[model samples]
Target: MSNANKHMPFPELTANEVSNLWSSFLMNSMQQRLLEYFLASTDDSKIKQIIEKILTQSQENINELKEIFDKENLNAPQGFTEKDVRIDGIKIFSDTFILNFCFDLTHLSISTYPIALSECTRNDIREHFQRNIAFTVKIQDEIVELMLSLGVYLKPPQVAIDSEVELADSFMYLNGFFGGSRPLNAAEIANLSRIIHRAQFSKMIFVTFSKLAKTKDLKQHFGKGRDGIEKVLNSLKEVLDKENIPISASGDYLISNVEASPFSDKLMLFFVNTCLGIFCFTMVNQAMTSSLRTDVVSKLGKISDDMKKFYGSGLLLAIKEKWFEQPPQAVDRKV
Candidate 1:
């Protein structure tokens, strides 16, 4: 490192950095509680080992985040606690579902951590995100290998590309509803496949949560979420179906009929609102931008609008129940 750069004082955390750190702390805390339950319930030794490792890592991350908050004199978020999870509750998801859940989390971390890292100017915060990204990538590889060995991995559709380079020479290539639309390109196919897969997983989660939710309102909210996901899946699947591309559905049978709630309504609602809700929007936005077909873009736009309404309602429910914690904010000088 250069002498001047090394000797320079650390800057105060930017608003972006503070927001990322705050969100990370809450996410990791919730994951820790969820993982603790998973670790207690899993019978597979391999899956148990992975769960243990991740749980430990989450605890460590929480401690580190606490130190950061302490240094800044920021009040730590309440996040989730032992009271939010019932470790003695009956196992609701299969071992495979647990593994896939962890795998899905890696996708969320990989996508967000780099963006957070880029937004940070402080050396300490940058290193924190960098470390998390690396750890999540490593765990993701391990989960994939295990899934492959167990014959549970669902691969995306394979397509053969032409050897010759081609360019879009006419506006007709973008047409979809008019029936002159060009064949789905690699990017469009990928985005469609990813969205389908994610939606399937999310639908299963919604179903499981709905069955276990304590309140009538929460159950209704989850039911609506499940319906919304199915609507999106059908629309996206039709685009792939027209091309005769096969899309594999994840196992909805993985959830057990255990009626007992393992997690508090607050935790489940927060998970849906932040993890699934934010990731869904991100994926749909990416698909919209990458897709050249007008029909595909239009479909995504409609889905995005639907998700905004559904998730917005969830936020209102959280607020009404006094479950939504306020994030750090600028001081009000007028006060």
Candidate 2:
């Protein structure tokens, strides 16, 4: 390495880099508050340790993002804060639910960070996402190990191996609409299982949030979310059931019936609107692209369309409540 290379001036952050950092800052800040509440309420020592690790990582990411925003002369977003969560509030979720939530968070990070990393032209921004990806992977492994030990891990459906290799010979291979369709492939099975699991989690979240929401309107919003997830789950589950694939049981029992809200309505709504809602679209798109069967793709398309409407409603609610934060925008030259 030449010393001159190190002395080269660094360029300004690109739009992609800023977008990643901004989104990341808001996510970590929200996660930090949620983890704090989880840490306060959790009783299991092992799960507590995991929450601590995640919380520390979230805090560190927020600090680094603050530094970047300051250096770029950009105002940091007013993401979730201490006011968003009441650490002393009664426990709303079982320890198992918290652990599973952590696992899902890591899963999302693993899926998304690489895309963020690839889009960045700046070295510092790339390094930030690189570190995030590495950390989430390690933590995800730990979470899996813990879940397996605790007997809470839900394994995906397994496909039997075939000794002989065969290639598709006819257009009928893609035909899933007519009778005598081909059996589900490994990729199709995996995507279906993943979507099912995500929907299960979302259902339970909506259940809990609905019960704890302060106002009737928010409660109805979350209740509708719960109902929407149920429909998606049924549609996807039917696809798997026709193939005789078994999925894990629902997590509805993991949520408590506590009527008191541990988190502010703003925080809860933002989470559903931004984090879970956006990720649902991403997963559906991935499934739709990977699915070879026409029927499977058609079902996924319908699911995606339903989610768009549901998430659109949530976004509108966020705006109406003033919970939606504006991202970075270009200055108006005319002004």
Put down candidate 1 lDDT per residue, 7-66, tens digits, no spaces: 787778899989999999988988998898898888899999889888988999999999
- Structure candidate 1, residue pairs in collision: none
Stretches of candidate 2 exceeding 4 Å from the true structure: 1-9, 251-253
List the candidates' TM-scores in order.
Answer: 0.96, 0.95
Judge candidate 1 against the unseen true structure and give its global Cα lDDT, from 0 to 1.
0.90
- Clashing residue pairs for model 2: none
Give each prediction's root-mean-square deviation over alpha carbons: 1.8, 1.9
Q: What is the C-alpha lDDT of each candidate?
A: 0.90, 0.88
